[model samples]
Target: MPLQFQDRVVLITGAGSGIGRATAVKMASLGASLALCDINYDNLESTSKLCGATTPKHLDDVDVSSNQEVRKFVDATATKLGRIDHVFNCAGVNPTSIPLEDTTDEYWDKLVNTNLKGVFNVTRAAIPHLKSGASIVNVSSISGLRGSAQQAVYCTTKYGLIGFSKCMALELGPRGIRTNVVCPGYIDTPTNAGIVKGGEAVERMVNGNALGRLGTPEDVADVVAFLFGEESRYMNGSVVEIDGGIKGTVLGGQERAKL
Candidate 1:
């Protein structure tokens, strides 16, 4: 049977683009109503349009890093949408990579605040409103599992998110609330567009993945949908990897051979 989300109220951050937008559209199609928030109002509007007639309550210019903003959004979502059955914590930023020596305090804070603290803010605010059987899916990265050359700050934030999600799962499990994180590798999202724009870079990314292709936003969205629904009712505190076997290759040093 197809996974169904009839009447579910889903709260999604970063719904302006990439995995967040894709998930919103997917859930909308599955009959779930949406409450979408994004720092980019224009992009968020575009995403809402793509939701195909289901008017999602939009909170624009919501910086997830701000607890106040996050709380306001969550409160509005619950008050407007009724209840938040699922939360997709997908609002994150990937700045250009810099070496530790070159990294500035501002850069570190930006990544940590947006990537790690943002998750905390959103989840914290939504928890009080999330009823039993609710699900929270956080968008971590393959970098969360392993370190990259010049991504010390980014890695730290992602790794911290994993730990945070696990703890949330344990604490919330008794309440019938599930918390899980998704780790995607080399997704062809706008966030990574600059890195993969060159043919050579694109080839390297493809060859690095055992699937021989980068993942699409929909690819990650499908997993998010599963985690949000009864299909993954038994899943909690799970760290799902949607990396197309990249974890095995990258961590096992198989990618070294290709280089």
Candidate 2:
């Protein structure tokens, strides 16, 4: 049986890499039409080439942090695609994980604007055109639910995304729109490749989680695909955790196992 989503118009921001790239390709594989936008034109085109070749319909270079740009992109998407049915608010950033004292004004502003305000801008712009029964998936992070030792700004932004998703669901569910958040744990993507490849961090991360393996972009994409369905029809304002069972594991610093 077809996994549905055939011919559905799905909009995904940050369609360049990590979960966003994976989701765009996944939806297209299942036959969904796409409206992709990103700040990086090359990466966006890479995702476009990987999609179902339904003529793309829309490809926008948008600074998602700005409401005006986001609104324009959304308007263009609906105008070009005729309507939008699903939106994956997946644009985000990872600031240097350093001590709070080391964080600067520019760093905080940049992180929040891209990671938090970006989500808000896209969702707000798309709300009017989101058809009834449509779904909106916000890409949050494990840091949103828990603390990260050196990622305060990043954590704060993701945590804010979770809150935004909840409030969005409350306001939009009445109109048959569903909003939800997905918090991914240590996904091994190009975005996090630097940290994941470090010898010490890699060994420790492996032993710390139940799965004993880092998450792939596709692992998160699978959950996103499920949430975009009737299986998750009743799941609104919900926070779906995709943390490799790390949330339930005991918290501590343990010696890394020899690989």
The lDDT leader among the candidates is 1
CA RMSD, predictions in order: 3.8, 3.8
Candidate 2 C-alpha error for residue 161, in Å: 0.9
- Across 1-259, the per-residue lDDT of candidate 2 in tens digits comes to 4849876789998888778889998988877878888899899989888875664558888889999999998998888878899999888876465688998999999989998999888988898898788999998877778775666787788889999999999999999999999988767777564354568766666656788887788998889999898789999999988867873532221221100
Model 2: residue 87 alpha-carbon error in angstroms = 0.9
Each prediction's TM-score versus the true structure: 0.92, 0.91
* Residue 210 error, candidate 2, Å: 0.1
Report the lDDT tens digits of candidate 1 across residue range 209-228: 77898788999998999998
Prediction 2 global C-alpha lDDT: 0.80
Question: Which structure among the candidates has the greatest TM-score?
Answer: 1
Global lDDT of each candidate: 0.83, 0.80
Model 1 clashing residue pairs (backbone): none
